[model samples]
Target: MTLSFELTQSVAILGGGPGGYEAALAAAQLGAEVTLVERAGVGGSAVITDVVPSKSLIATADAAVAIAEAGDLGVQLFAKGAHGKPLKPEIAINLAAVNKRLLTLARQQSDDMRAALVEAGVRIITGHGRLDSDNAVVVSTGPGGTDFDRVEADTLVVSVGASPRQLPSAMPDGERILTWTQLYDMTALPEHLIVVGSGVTGAEFAGAYMNLGATVTLVSSRERVLPGEDPDAATVLEKVFTRGGMTVLSKSRAEKVERSGDGVVVTLTDGRTVEGSHCLMAVGSTPNTRGIGLEEAGVQMDASGHIRVNRVARTSVPNIYAAGDCTTFVPLASVASMQGRTAVFHALGDVVIPLDRRRITANIFTAPEIATVGWQEKDVAEAHINGIVHKLPLAANPRAKMMGVRDGFVKLIARQGSGTVIGGVIVAPRASELIYPIAIAVERRLTVDQVSRVFAVYPSLSGSITDAARAMHHVERADED
Candidate 1:
């Protein structure tokens, strides 16, 4: 990548998210006067309310699970184990204190990022920003939102992000019926939690709550949870959920959520009713694209209202670019940052490569997290180039056996003739941490043999990664015979 080019133009970014701040820094580094306008403090929903908060909640749940399963490992502080009789210990969770810590950590991260941007000579404005006419931006501040502001820019980047989707039939009262972001406001664990829509967010919160001693019910409209993920991996996760005593109502769609006394009742399309102490609506998210004056500025948006952008993050209108969940692309914080940086490079006339979405690594933070990178098995043209799909279960790994872990595996997708690694999937505890090497292989266009030859630590879960790659190579060699 070029260090810098003729990128001396004025750049203005809207939203203080990963994409917006990253773009500001990149533009500033390229000798441009950069300014970032944000309504929230910094870090966007990813830090303030959504991603970081949920992950922190999951961490607490994981700790609870570790202690609950301590007996199975022959390490017990109590007389409860499979070696003896399973003891039922009443577990208590302080959700208020938990949420407080989560928010604290989130704010601290935002503050740290703010310090870095200020040090980088990027001007920060605390306000809601909107596009004005002809390469101009208007930022409004103050409690009344009447605070005046004007910004002149040679280029603009919009990364306003998205919010939780709300349904008319199932409106959230922020009490019994809640959105994902409102989960942190609880002071106690819900007795019977009904998670509607078993997507990644719904599944994660459902599993975490179940681990924390709550009786959980997951309502899914799809045939299985994580309908967008690999079917095999989704099956493994669904099995795990069932084994954990979660009531999975598959093919059930929520029609309405109503309050009954202090509890909530969810009505399904097929005349089924589910009652729970609290209802979590994880239907998906709507982009925060309304009232941003984007249409007036002539920036094109998709039918779903997400800004349309090219691989380099350029929008239909010249001098304007879009990134993050607000755009018509896959949403991830890492992808947003890369798109932002790419937009700055393109705007500044610097030599830069367009973002390759196929190389994007995605981690779904479930108990046994699902992580994948590059092209999938379905993506390979088997007729054109022979593709091999090799999977190695973690049960065969020494580490998994030692830890009494089961129900996850590593899968590799490769072209048998060329041995070129394309995609991989890891379905195990901490799979999120294991998908990097596969991503690197895809990025560098490494062969299966090359990945297999790399050394992974002995008696480790990661050994499955290289070992699976090696297994693919063996199959390829066998096909040659």
Candidate 2:
């Protein structure tokens, strides 16, 4: 079927993140003229600062860990020494070189995004855009600076994105106290790193830095790490981190951060102080909703400054819609892209699939990556169906043993009565890549028996997944008997 829309209406998408760009592409494909206005580069925070850079840094850290563990697999290294005696192997990392490569890759991604949008016939405008009214947007050539141009559109998409939330007492100076966005500017590695929060971002940075040869201390206000993730996954991560020489301070909330000589001191709410050569505040992100003309234009926002929108991405005001991190929806690149597409679909009167929060999969990129889908363990415990949890340790897998992987497991949660897979958690090397089959299983409501029938490679790490499914099947059968 040919999908077409009335060309009379035009759309102006503000902010060029995954949401904005994807929405622009969708709109253009549906025959609506689109103009994308962005203050930063095309890929927004996901590319220019946060996700791309941090993941690239994590990749380097993963490589370092792999090298360090190579010796266990009988790999030996030698260096030239006096009299041909055995020499200690040295691994050197150039921070500047890593940053250069990271920025190069990020820029390439941004360029590709721009090229794709252009090819889709969307006009790209480099500026900070704000809605003047329901159907008009004023674009400023610079952020918080004057030179403005107003563009009129029949449909408005607000994908203004978000910024790093900063506490007044712990303001980031881009030096001693830093945000994740500022880490790319460093030419040298930190001697000691203190990461505040213990959330996904903090845990990820702490793990990455520790792997990269830095002494890391993770401070969390909660009783355990990763309060937002599955308890089992969090417990495994905490154990792995402590075993890897990371000092974790749970139930400790940072009250203030102050510069001390060349380093910084983070004072806890309990009056205890922790000092480190560098501190990264990974508390959370704030929506970029301030000064965006939302109130004047009758667009509604929630208490947390996120724009209020329905499943279709429609704002309180008709003809105005919001998507991405700026909206009340969960902040993820995948969710943002879907929200964008949904907004365009609803706006153009096309077949629209409302946003499904349940099916979205999220990953935390630590040494042993954590990936989850569908209902969480906490939710399953409180639900109607009795849940069975099966965990298969990677240590028992032949491929994991061969690869020298000691810390990780594949966990599957299934409904006790129906045997339908409800959720899955993978904690292992390349867990991100290994999570697709589980995600598909959960999405399709596949039974444990069905999942177990799929043949995984013998002696492969992925075999653990199938093994976990089989274990779940055994538990279900026992329960039935």
Candidate 3:
């Protein structure tokens, strides 16, 4: 039961993302001398570029949507100088202000992380850390410098996160052709935006730009947008996007992206071209595995370049572990944190729990925020499970109507034989928050009746979840009759 490692030896963590930093903190708490190395600033891409900045941009767009819908509450609008003329609604989003706030927030996060690590007595080194051997790491400091530092460690945790994958034909110019990481640098809003992928990142940016007063065209190679998410939820999102003046081109593949005189052109595989003021490449991400000495140290990686690691985050090498997007696990901040913590416990020979992917909850942060947990309907149908799926639309919920939310629904999947809830999906504003209760239910194997007994506040959006549970109970009773 002892979680402490020998004080004589030290632990080294590579990359300063959520995974690596969490592991460093845990190791330090367990009385292990820890050294964390990062080539980029602390907090990594999640805090500086991807998650924090995108969510902040979304918050701005949400505020605009709220202001535009104020007339539904019987609020009157009048011009300042005119006698009775109604004022024309305008949403002016200053990109400079937004970018300034983004940088400020990112710096704050970095400072807080550094302070925490320092408080825990963990040494922070700003350098590129690569494994020289199973127990040795070489650090290269200050990009384009000759100085290097090498250190030996008892245990190693690799959490070097993923980077945006770019196609050979579509190199980013940082002005016209941009990646998600570079979008915050835009000072002027694009008049017409062409988004070249339909995954979570693509869909989110497309929806956000469309809401922020830009004409968006979402090009998807698959038959539907957000192919990795629930089919029903994706369908709802596609419908909402289309209704909001977004031109979604499904089953279309972009062969190459090139810059026109003043704009950009995306040539499709089917001999069609789409033009826009700017193009965003959201194809996917690749793990930062190459040139890090993973192969030299005998650490295994998958075909897609993701490091192969066990449930407890151990790699092929006994003392080496990998976590976060670099490992072959669900690429999420929450899962990454858990994987990092698990690696420390397993390495220290403490109480370690293997990762359970089924218990994990994920969300696509679109306008309505699609969130899900546990089994999916497609998996249940493929397995031929006798389960009932119940859906309750937000249209029927009073709280949604009051809040001016017209789209989205809550769906519950339960075993027909036992009426035990096994999976759930929520597509609503703040659906990420709403899905956690259902996630807890599914993880605990709670029955539909048990979920129904929990009182949801009247005139609250979560009431739809309870209503879905009741509907499932009604259907079960009807089947028996």
Candidate 4:
């Protein structure tokens, strides 16, 4: 297919993920002709497989958890076919329907994003796009990716996100051995699911399947699950996992995985073995930087294959930018969108505001979800950022008491000298939503006193957040006195 380049200023964005598509919309809004090239649909892995699918399944699992505790609150759950007769409560999950719903929700979200971009007058080309010489993008088209199209642009934005990193010894067959992306495709709940690499992804899935009534064995190479998260929160999660019939093996690294008599065995590096009906590897992700012509185009990248970009998302090559997981930065959907927008603004000659890494919030979507923003306790202890920390238990909140929540807390970090809200962490249900106010406080440089003054609903989980801030405010006052 032959198509002429737009005479007006055009931005060609590769990868229709959060970073790429968001940049396309922003550039289109900025009066630049934007064209987005993507092999997959819009919204990328966040909507397609990683974020949306996993979280949607987590919702189902969380509902099961809540229902399991309904009897304590005088709510009786009857079997659907019991005809009003009380029988033993059962949480029977339809794996086929669940997987179908997960995939449907993901594609629907991708469709919604695509419709928005189309409405914004962005031309979307379906293909694997790569940087070519002479300020152009070569899109590999047709059924077999042989036919191609050379598209012209004034500037280029590369936002192709990363993929699940595979191990040579333990290869995922997308059936017995699976990656996080293929987990939702299973037709049946694994009888004994063995999860390796207990990072955010592994912990979330392991907790979710356990809630869904699966026998789970969590293999953590580290001393505890979610090693990157807060120690207190990780401790709480590990406790919950162990209490919920999950067998957690700490400091055990899976060296090889093989099929053994219709089951999977994960042999540890220490010569130990874990056997299960299925296995999932949540090791990490590798950036999709190869064959994108990034290096040939003179774009700088770190040794680990992530593109090296500045605060404004500029690469080593002039007029070319890299954003999202493709760059060596925090892998958050929100952060990726901001990086994409920042790149588009700088490229389109608009006012450029560099991304603030400190103000970003990250959340792990396991039960009793953990969310954090701004300076961490380690950062303060290391003198990287000075902050006073105050923690309040969720059990102290009236709403938490009503909801029977007992295993979570809120921690607020305020600047030592100014008492300005610097960072905070929340370990509770919907902590993702809870972190927003803390993020706003940090972003606006609001003080602990100011945050505490903001009226939180009485007896609510938000009250715990405010209480933590109040505790810090009191400490600041006492220190000043």
Give residue 125's lDDT in candidate 1 (0 to 100).
92
193-228 in candidate 3: lDDT tens per residue?
Answer: 999999999999999999888999999999999998
- Give the per-residue lDDT digits (tens) of candidate 4, residues 204-307: 99999999999999999999998887888899999999999999999898999998877899999999998999999999999999988988888889888999
**Higher-TM-score candidate of 1 and 2:** 2
Instruction: State the local distance difference test value for candidate 3.
Output: 0.89
TM-score of each: 0.95, 0.95, 0.95, 0.96
Q: After superposition, how far is residue 70 of candidate 2 from its true place, in Å?
A: 0.6
Give the TM-score comparing model 3 with the true structure, all chains together. 0.95
Cα-based lDDT for every prediction: 0.89, 0.88, 0.89, 0.89
Residue 23, candidate 2: C-alpha displacement in angstroms: 0.7
Q: What residue runs in model 3 are displaced by over 4 Å at the alpha carbon?
A: 1-9, 82-86, 384-386, 474-481
